[model samples]
Target: MTQAAIQVRDLCFQWPTGASVLQFCSLDVPKGEFWMLLGTNGSGKSTLLRLLAGLLQPQSGEIKISGQVGFVFQNPDHQLVMPTVGADVAFGLVEEKLSLAQIQARVHEALTAVNLQLLQRRPIYALSGGQKQRIAIAGAIARQCEILLLDEPTALLDPDTQLDLVAQVRNLVKSRGLTALWVTHRFDELNYCDGAFLLEQGRVVDRGAPEHLKQRLMQ
Candidate 1:
């Protein structure tokens, strides 16, 4: 069997007001593969993604993820902290003990990966929505994260940018040998994934071939 990069077994969670979000949810994404999570609103897809990213703690169950984790928010404005592209990309490395030269090298490599190296000196405010999203991705790459968790990274972009972003991520996964779990509602985005999971009422109702899941939803 293929080894899993992200593994969750019987995971459970609820809000402080007692609104249950997950009910013994379980999933496993094999190493070096790309998977998408599909669900209607309030299906606990975002909650599950946040839990996997460690942004929120589950009340019960287990989440095991190998290697470093990178999270891209649905809104890039919510995650980008620094003023400039280069500064923001390197921001995550602040907690690491790397030297200045090493940090710069990492930032360069990451920006290049996202095709944003030329905009390194650009201000965050001057960027379009698409560029800002790419910068957010570059931040994760700079951290050398082996796994990526994106919660609707294309929601705010135009149709063209959305498809482009998804294609870019697929290439990144294949070229870098990284694993990714993206939460999305757009069925068109399904074409780029290796597999997919359908979330309903906080549990995974269907999973496996992306095309199969797509057809199931359409019918």
Candidate 2:
């Protein structure tokens, strides 16, 4: 079997208000696989994504990741902080103590990868919602993370822009061999995924190819 890029074993969690969320959830994601996570509101999809990103600690169980992980949250505002697009992409590299030359190179490469090279110097706040989300994606790519996690990445995007973003994501997975887990409520959005997991009431109730799962869901 391929070594799992991400592993969650017997995971459990709850909010401070004593609302139980995840319970005995276990999952294994292989390297370079594209996995879509589906669930209704308050069904622990976002919670599980946060746990995998190491942003939230599970109350019980073990989580292991084999490579650097990048997380793009539902809201672009939470990820983009620098005044300009260039600065935002270079932020994480600076933290890694990369030299100025190296940071600039990586930033340029990431921007070009997302087809946003021309927007590097633009003021972040002046960009449209789709542009801002692309900037966030560039920043994550600049980090050189092998695993990319996105939560409702295209929720607020127009149809055209959403398709563009999905294409970019697909390229990242194919070109960089990046492992991705996308969480969303829309089943139609998952046509690009290699496989999928269906969650109901905080547990994974089904897992299979997206087409197969869709057939089962319809039945």
Candidate 3:
């Protein structure tokens, strides 16, 4: 069996209002796999991602992630802070204390991995929605995160752009051997996922291959 990149055992969480938001007996994301998390609004998809990213702590049980996490929000505007593509990608590395040359190399490599090296100097405000998404991904790549936590990243994109963004993410994941937990409500997007889990009221109700889940859901 493949080693688990992320493991959650008996995890539980609640809002400040004391209302439970998530309760998972166990969950696993295998190394180098693309897993889609499907649910409607208030299903706790975003909350789960936050927990995995260490933005929130579980009230009970254990959560184990093997390596660093890079999070991408649904809106690119929320993730981006710098004025230009290159600067934005480098922003995450500034605190690493690496030499200037090392930072530049990493930024260049990350941009190239996303096929956006040419646009490194482009202004963030001038980018198309799809391009901004790519830039956001490049920042994650630059961080060299072992696992990526994406919270409904394609929610704001057009259908065609959404598909393109998924393809780009698929290529990058395969080449980098990174584990990704992506949250989305679009059933069609499951075509890009290796497997998927259905979340209902903060509980995992179903798990299987993406095609199998899609067929079952349709039926």
User: Cα lDDT of all candidates, in order?
Assistant: 0.94, 0.86, 0.88
| Pairs in clash, predicted candidate 2 | none
- CA deviation > 4 Å runs, candidate 3: none
Among all windows of 10 consecutive residues in model 2, the one with the lowest summed lDDT is 184-193
Tens digit of per-residue lDDT, candidate 3, span 1-219: 999998888788999999998886467889999898987799888988998888899889788899889898999998899999999999999879899999999999999988899998999999988889888888888988878888899999999999998878887778899999899989889999989888887678888899888987889
* lDDT comparing candidate 2 with the true structure: 0.86
Per-residue alpha-carbon lDDT of candidate 1 for residues 166-200, written as tens digits (9 for 90 to 100): 99999999999999999999989999999999998
- The collision pairs in model 3 are none
TM-score of each: 0.98, 0.96, 0.97
Which candidate, 2 or 3, has the higher TM-score?
A: 3
Please report how far candidate 1 places residue 125 from its true position, in Å: 0.8
- The TM-score between candidate 2 and the true structure equals 0.96
RMSD of 1: 0.8
